[model samples]
Target: MNTTPSYRTIAGDGLWSNNLGLVQLLGLCPLLAVSGTAINGLGLGLATLLVLLGANLCVSLIRHWIRPEIRIPVFVLIIASFVTAVELLMSAYFHQLFLILGIFIPLIVTNCGILGRAEAFASKQPPLPAAADALAVGGGFLLVLVVLGGLRELLAQGTLFSQAHLMFGDWGRGLSVTLLEDYRGYLLAALPPGAFIGLGLLLALKNLIDQRRAAVAKAAPALTTQQANTP
Candidate 1:
């Protein structure tokens, strides 16, 4: 068995093939709800990334001792503990953002992205590879959250990082970029329906790109064969 996954495979997993948001479609509840604003999405995504890394490391470390029958429960318990710690820490330090995030903070424990990594990769691998996989998967999830959040924020509010201080400290309060002074916020883009529409459009775009790539590959073989035959 190959112990190491290649750099190409890692990049593909993080960017496209096993993308947490567009492909796995995990953690949609928090992904859709908090993605109304760029800062909100960034905050949530970073927290999730931390939790995933911690959980993956713990699971990988204990993979040998854990029996098959009890592994899932063990993983969930570990994840839930980390999430609770994160929730409390956020509430204490970033009270405003914590309130804004609300239940979604706790909901991170149940996110399929974290749990899936524990079951699929960490349970079988050593600490280093498992950590790498967690990073790739978590990074992928964060990429989607940030992109969707940026899109929604720009369209709905005509601003980027409008409320950065809510997550970051006082310095971030003035970090917002105003794209339009006389802008009317689009209610549709800030709503749940908008998330579905945006996600669907993104998925469609990805599929279209994949199809084009596939077509080029298919045509290349035919063209090469024809050229060989002609000569």
Candidate 2:
């Protein structure tokens, strides 16, 4: 049995075909909660990415030694350890963002996406592929967070990257983009319902694109055969 998955397959799984945030719908708690703005999402996303990368690498390196009966606990420990390190790092550096994220920072340990990758991919694959998988998965998650956060912030506050200082210091304060001038924002977009509605719309958009791609793929062979026969 080939225990290792190819880097391409890993990329496909993480980025598009089976994204942690979009496809698998994992980690929605923090995804929906703290993603009220782009800065908040970026901060949490980076923290999660850091934890996933570390946990995946560590699990791959030590996978052979862990007994199957205790693998779950071992995985949890590995993930929790990395999550703690990330939380402390954020607190030490980006104190404002850290305070905003609060318990969700520590709660990355409970994100099934990180643990799932460790157990499913990292545990079976070599370190290189494991790392690739982590990057791909983390990248997909980061993209979703940024997009969703941007959307919500734009709708709620007529601005993008609001409070960028929380993540990027004072210089980042200038990164905020104003879309609407002298206009009040939608109240719902400032609430949890906005996250749900935005997520649902995003999911529908992805599904629509997927369906179109599937239709094109399904017709290609038939069209090819018909052309050959006519010729």
Candidate 3:
């Protein structure tokens, strides 16, 4: 009755092969909206991950108790509970980040990646695997957000971790790196339109990398067999 996925499989699916932003293409709204800076993306990503982690654990524990007919609703309610907790925490500690991210923080409740996992993986798997899956998936999502945020911030303003204090308070202000002191910022890269452009370019880069890896994998077996036959 154990439906736990292997660690490799879980990691691959959650981090790369089935990522929410890059692969599955879920949660695009916040993925593109709040990622104007590294801290913004990191904050939201952490929130989403926290909610996913708690939701998956809760769903796995109650999976058998809920009737099949109302399972979806039950799963949603569970996710909402976690989202509420996450929202409150953010509002309390990272009040500045909470204001900047605004509605996106609360909207984590509607992200399909969360609900999809609850129904597909967590509901069927044991608690340990479910938690692992959530971690992998959330890590992947957070990574993409961070990378995207970094890309935009660096390209637009020639800085890294700009406005990090919003998340880390006074100490975080010191972490902001000024890569280009006099660099004129790129207007497009600082706007919402820029997120789409950056994301598209990132997708192209990922696809190129994937294609090269696939080709290499495909050629390896053929080359080995040919060498063996020749000998």
- TM-score of each candidate structure, all chains considered together: 0.92, 0.97, 0.97
How many clashing pairs does model 2 include?
0
Comparing 1 with 3 on TM-score, the higher-scoring candidate is: 3
Extract clashing residue pairs from model 3. none
Candidate 1, residues 123-219, lDDT tens digits: the string is: 8888888888878888888888888898889889999999899877899979999998999999899999998888888889989999999999999
Q: Rate the local accuracy (lDDT) of all candidates.
A: 0.88, 0.91, 0.93
Report the C-alpha lDDT of model 2 over 62-180, residue by residue, as the tens digit: 98899999999999999999988898899899998899999999999999999999888889888899899999999999989989999999999999987988888889989878889
Q: Which of 1 and 2 is ahead in TM-score?
A: 2
Pairs with steric clashes in candidate 2: none
Candidate 1 vs candidate 2: the lDDT winner is: 2
lDDT of 3 by residue, 4-122 (tens): 67999999999988888998999999999989988889999999999999999999998889899999999999999999999999999999899999999989999999999999999
Distance from true position, residue 82, model 2, in Å? 0.7
Q: Number of backbone collisions per candidate, in order?
A: 0, 0, 0
Between candidates 2 and 3, the one scoring higher on lDDT is 3
How do these models rank on TM-score, best leading? 3, 2, 1
